[model samples]
Target chain A: MYFENFASLVDMGGHGIYVWPTYALGLLVILYNIVSPMMARKKIVTQIRRQAKAANNRKKPASSDTGRKVNSHEQFSANGQQQASTTESSRTVNEGE
Target chain B: MNWTFFHKLGSPKWFYEISGKWLPWLAILAALMMATGLTWGLLFTPPDYLQGNSYRIIFLHVPTAFLASAIYVSMAIAGAVTLIWRIKLADMALKCMAPIGTSFCFLALLTGAIWGKPTWGTWWVWDARLTSMLILLFLYFGVIALRGAIRSATTQARACAILTLVGVVNIPIIKFSVQWWNTLHQGSTLKLTEKPSMAPEMLWPLLISIAAFYLFFTVVLIIRLRTEILDRERRTKWVRNAVEAGARS
Candidate 1:
């Protein structure tokens, strides 16, 4: 029987060099087809999460209105946290600008 | 039968909800069938008297070849439905089928090559059947590439629909290539019209394997269609709810 040993399957009646590679390639293609969409889904989910965080941050301003408009950088840090302790504090500072 | 349900079929949300109910059953049945088929094919079936152990590759090759063609035909139908009826789910199904069809085509080619080396004394040949199958692979790549290159989903779907219709012409070419030209590729072993040429021991597993492949194709297609639906409907309330629930978990 062909199942006599691992070597027999590998040898495949002297067709090993061709047969084994074909099986290997077929298995690889199947594995990749199953795995790729999963990876793409992960990538998309990460992008959507980042977009939602940005949209939420955009809705709330960092400081109050002033005689002169306050720049976003002056009101909040690059990381999107408020630099001004309170809107009142920033309003006083903004009048000078 | 309720004809009004035809209108409901056009709705993405309805299909998504319905598909969710159907997917689990399809998956479970597919797994069961595939397991039974492969087990019967790999173990219990006796070797061929003429070709011996190498004939075993037939179990893998023929079924995948069958699927490779069937998927393309199904895709063309979905493409037609999407173009004429404007059913978004049909468009999604056509898109999802591309990768699955490509995978099956690849398997058919690979297994055929393996079988050829043992039976035909070479791993590769430019025989009519093989050449036409290679063209089918290229046609699949063309469809995928054209879809990816287009920026708008609707436009892309339309373009793919047209391309799929054009590719349908190639399917017959592949089928008849063996007959049209004398080639190294052997004629089909199993035929619907003729009595099966193989012994019962070999024929049974081969039949089981084909059924298994059909089930496996359905399972993968449903999973892919679900993913496509969710992605397309991300802005909808149901999708948003699903996303939030998923995020929480």
Candidate 2:
């Protein structure tokens, strides 16, 4: 609003080149900060969900949490696809909601 | 003074659930404040008589620089907590904050170089302020690389804590660099004990941007911390349930 016209706003009396790029870079940094973590969360959830599915397919799916079998989660996750007789490798890696 | 919060603070699950609730609000506030500050600084604020429009870079440059230093200090405090109390959450914080801190430090240095060109007629100078800031960037890198290099989780945590504590010495040097030795970088515009040497309109946006950047950092740090907590605590049943029940945090 300080500028008289749009041209002057962009031109900034000849400093636009510097000002604009700095802002564009700022925008990129902000987006990266948001996107990176979201992706990580998605990946983690998908892996866990797959492990749960594998455990269910293999046996009576450890019906409980705290009193559940130790190393069950890791046992399924590490060899989830390898032991999966039905070829879980191609199973949709769904990140549960 | 009630001290029960310290124990709660050390609980990763408590932090994960709590931060999840706060993330949305903080993200919205940070976005709003950042947009307001940048727009005001870019358009509404008058051009400086001396530096012309190039001074506007200060909007991002100064805020990122402030955060780079503040994040390092926060990392050091987290490091100290990890060392003294052996808090797993503090160690997680120290680990998660490294990437965010490094990004901001890189931004600050890049923006500073850009701002330097038009005003100082050079991209960089081997002065105290610039050199010290560069060292701070390297310190961030050192901690991050050290974390990746060590295979054992406990050893990695301790090594990073000691490194962060040692590198904390550079923060004060960065603070006093502009004054201790005459440097190309200008002295601080906003000071605690002195009136800001800036026009009211310009100062307002800069201050708002500083607050926005801090909020933005917290928003990002919490998200990162939550991911870290999930990764480390995956074996626990609570983490398993939380990951399955919750959507992308």
Off-target runs (Cα >4 Å) in candidate 2 are: A61-97, B1-3
- DockQ, structure candidate 1: 0.08
Quote the B-chain TM-score, candidate 2: 0.98
Instruction: Measure candidate 1: CA RMSD.
Output: 10.7
**Per-prediction tally of clashes:** 0, 0
The models' CA-based lDDT, in order, is 0.71, 0.83
Q: Per-residue CA lDDT of candidate 1, range B162-227, in tens?
A: 999889888988887777899888776777799878788778778887887787787677667766
What shift in Å separates residue A68 of candidate 1 from its native position after superposition?
A: 23
User: Which docking category, incorrect, acceptable, medium or high, applies to candidate 2?
Assistant: acceptable
Q: Could you give candidate 2's per-residue lDDT for residues B84-154 as a string of tens digits?
A: 77777888899889989898999999988988898999999999999999999999999999988886666
Off by over 4 Å in 1: A5-12, A16-18, A49-97, B1-3, B247-249
Candidate 2's interface RMSD, please? Answer: 10.3
User: Candidate 1 lDDT, tens digit per residue, A53-86?
Assistant: 5545765787544432345323322223223321
